[model samples]
Structure formats: C-alpha cells, structure tokens
Target: MARKAQTPDIGPFDRHSISLRVDHVRQLFQTLDPYPFTERDLDKDAEEFIVSWARELTGDGPIRIVIHLPAQEASSAEGRKLGNAVRRYFEERTRAVSLDLRECFRLGRLSLAIGASVLALCMLGAQALSQHSFPGSLQSFLTESLIILGWVANWRPMEILLYDWWPIARHRNLLRRLSVADVRIVAVSPDERSHPPH
Candidate 1:
C-alpha cells in the first residue's frame, strides 16, 4: 500500500461535502489530483485519497461523497461507457469476496474428508497387521506418521471454516457502506466552477 498523502488545506469544508472529478477524454476516467502527481496510476491514487478522506470523516454518521463533472459528461455515450466501467470494477471487487469464500469452504471440506479417510485407513492397517509380528517401534512410527498426515490435512479446513472469512467479510462490508453513501456530482459550469444543479 502507498503511504497516504497529507490532506491539503481545504479549509471550511461543509460537513456534507467531499469532492472528486474525472477528467474524461471521450468518456474515460481521468486523474483528479491537483498537481505534482507522478504519471504512474494517478487516477487510482486520487480515488484512494478521496475514499480515505471520506472514511476519515465518517464519525458514526454518514458523510457525503461527491463527484464533479461537466453537465454533458453524464449524458454522453462515452460517459455512459465510463460509468459502466466503474460499475464493473466495484462489482468485481464485491464478487471476489464471495468467490474466494466459496473456494475456502470447498478446500476446507476436502481437507476434512482426506483427513478422515487417512485416519480410517491407518486404523484398518493397524488392525490387520496386529496378527503379524509387527515390531512395536514400527507400529508406533506408522501410527504417529498417519496422525501427523491427518492433522496436516485437517488444518486448512479448520482455518478456513473458522477464521479466514472474517477479513473478507469486513472488507465487503466496508465497500457496501461506501457504496451506499450520499454520492452527489457537482456540475461544473461554463466558468469552470462546481455547483449543484438547480
């Protein structure tokens, strides 16, 4: 993760205002950074800054999220395309949590099954070999080996079933909260000033 940028002296903020913009080129998202940002991934950096600030201001209440754009930006075919792209990015992120969660569960179940089978096989082997002159040391070694292998097989499923999903769930929850915030777009007027539409 990149170090968070220092908050600029944006003084006298209205409690309901958090602003960002996309400098669209034929409907593409552009960097909202004011200046001095490096060429590498400036768009994402600016977005992260906006989201970070939004989260910072959230003190047990909903804060505003604003996107500034020219009036025509939302009406153009290209603008619609850009909106779709943004939608896909967020949708994919949210979807990934569930997909990974399912995979974890699947892997956990598989591990448990394998562990149980290994233990059962060990028990059957020990019983069958009991009639033979099985060396006591060799029997102990075989039993211990099977126990270790069974534990290794069961470990992943236990971890996945018990603990792995919490972080993903938390992340998804954060995204969900951010998505539902009061997001507004201030229309940039002819004089290049931003204002809410009448």
Candidate 2:
C-alpha cells in the first residue's frame, strides 16, 4: 500500500513571511489611481508599493522595513515636506523605485468569497444534475449551465467587490515596516520548525 502524502503545517511566522508579487502590487495601483489622492491614500500606496518591491527585489523572502514620518496631512506644507523626506529616505535605502499602490485587501477578500461561493454552487448543481441524469430539455440545461459558468468566470472580479464592502481593509499604514531579510528565489522547502519540534 502506498503512503498518502502528508500536508505540511503552516505557522503564523511562515505565513507572515510570505511576500506579495510585483504584478499583484501593480494591479493594486491600477485600481487606486481612479480615486482622488489623499494623505491616507498616499500612505497606503507607499507602504504596499514598498512591500511589493521589497519582495520582488529580495526574491519573495521574509523582510521588514521601518518607516518613520510626521503625523500630518500631505496637503499641508509640513506634511508635504515630511512626505518628501520619507520618500528620499526610502529612495536611498531601498533598491527599487518608489511606486504607489494602495490597499486592495478588502477587494481581495471579497473576490475569494465570491469565487468560493460560485465554485460551491457550481459543484452542487453539477452533482445534482449528474445524479438525476440530464433532463432532455436543451433550453433548461443551457440556461442552468450558463448561470453556473457565468459565476465561475466572474470569480476574478470578486476581489473588487471585497474592496468596496470593507472600508477598513482599504486603509493601511503609511509607514510600513519589514525586518530580517532572507531572499528565496524559488519557493523554499518547508522549514522543519513548521511542525512542532518533537
């Protein structure tokens, strides 16, 4: 008898260490550009962009960066000055260009939920149809199949809806922090510590 493959345990630290992809950040930026820019918007964009760039440059490895800035609105002179100073600090400190990408976290969550629900519904319908045998009515089958397929196909857009529903998820700290850089060009082997040490 063949042994079934065991799924590895994932720890909080392991999950935290996961990095967002560059393309993902780019898409996020595209979404945010349509909205009017605000201090909060600038901050969120800065943090997400830095995090994404850091991941890309460091090869999707665990890292942390500390951001410091004055508490002021960017519309004000003091705020603008502080923002520029922080920008320069990052420009000098990090390897990649500063790109603004605001929070799409809520959108992402929504997208997941929508996709999951759609997939579940489709699976349920398929099972029902298979069990009962297809009814010979072409119109009914076509209509039902189209509805299921439409939801499945639209799963990609769930992310956008997620963003809209949740306001908090859209606002991220302007000053982001990352620490202890370790670059892994390819996915790393699961750390032995992933499981409780015997």
Candidate 3:
C-alpha cells in the first residue's frame, strides 16, 4: 500500500479577540481618488484592512474580531448613511472573496478529473504494450516509459485535489469568519471600551 505524504496542520487560528476603534466613519471612508465611489473604490479599504489583519494572526484556533465605530452620528441622517455604507462595504467584499474561493475549488476538481483520466489511459496502454509480440527489449522499454508518463500525468491533479486545495479552503473559512465578525457602533463614551474578554 502506498502512503500519502503528511502535510502540516494549518488551522482556524486563535487570538485574544481584537478590537479597533473607528472614532469617525467619515475619516475611514475618505479616499484621495479623483473619482469618488467608482467601481475600484468599493470595498477597497475594508479588504485591505482584512488582508493586513489576517497577516498578523498567529494561533491555532478561531478568535473574535470586533470593529467599533462611533455611535454618535454627526447628525441622525448622516449617521444612518454612514452605518449603511460601512455595512455594504464589508458585504460586497465578502461576496467577492467567496465567489473566487468557489471558482478555485471548481477548477481544482476539474483538473483532478482530467489528470486521473489521462493517468488511467497511460497505465492501460503500458499493460497492452507489454502483452504484444513486439521485440522484447523495445516492448519492455515502452512499458517502462508509459508507466513513468502515467505517474507524471497523475502528479498535478493529486496535488491540486489533495494538498493545494486544503490551504485555500482554510483561507476561505477565515475570510468568511472575518467578514461576518461583530461590528459594533459604540457611543462616544469611555464606558464602551471596558469589556471583559470572552
């Protein structure tokens, strides 16, 4: 029986739940681009923050992420608008990453199927060639060559379906976790800052 190579366990990391205070939502959304609210601008800031945050993490289990924004709106109307904008930003970014992750999985599965098919065909050819009444030395050489090619063909699909996809799957889960994280709008008061860790 052939043994599969062991891969390191990359997992849902743990951390002392993190919190970031956004004193003013307007400051966070202000971008210097000449064109405001362009296609490129949507979710740009939020994704960047998430990616940078993901990089700093080092743990073995999941942790809570909290983003606290100012509860006191500049005005009631503006406050509502600002809150809506922030929520939409994270929602759009989450959708984009989720779609990409799904596509990656789909492509990996297709490649796996194709590679396995080719490997099987090559192996069958090797067996057929070995049984033919051709010159003995030439027949043996052809059989060896086919077997080698089959293994080569099998390599990528095996890696894609087995090894490569694991990390991507793990990353997708992390992104999802981050996206749906607790987003609280705290009033401009010191009492909001004091909370015991869970």
The TM-score, computed over Cα atoms with residue i paired to residue i, of candidate 3 is 0.60
Predictions in order: lDDT: 0.54, 0.39, 0.56
TM match of model 2 to true structure: 0.27
Number of the top candidate by lDDT? 3
Q: How far is candidate 1 from the true structure (C-alpha RMSD, Å)?
A: 8.4
Candidate 1, 1-198: lDDT as tens digits: 222222223344445345665544222234453432222122456447645665566443554455556768755564444434444444555577668767777887887788778767766766665556655588667766766765676677678778987877766655555544555444556565333332
Number of the top candidate by TM-score? 3
TM-score of each: 0.57, 0.27, 0.60
33 Cα displacement, candidate 3 (Å): 8.7
Assess the local accuracy of residue 14 in candidate 1 as a C-alpha lDDT between 0 and 100: 47
Each model's RMSD to truth, in Å? 8.4, 18.0, 10.8
Error of 2 at 41 (Å): 13
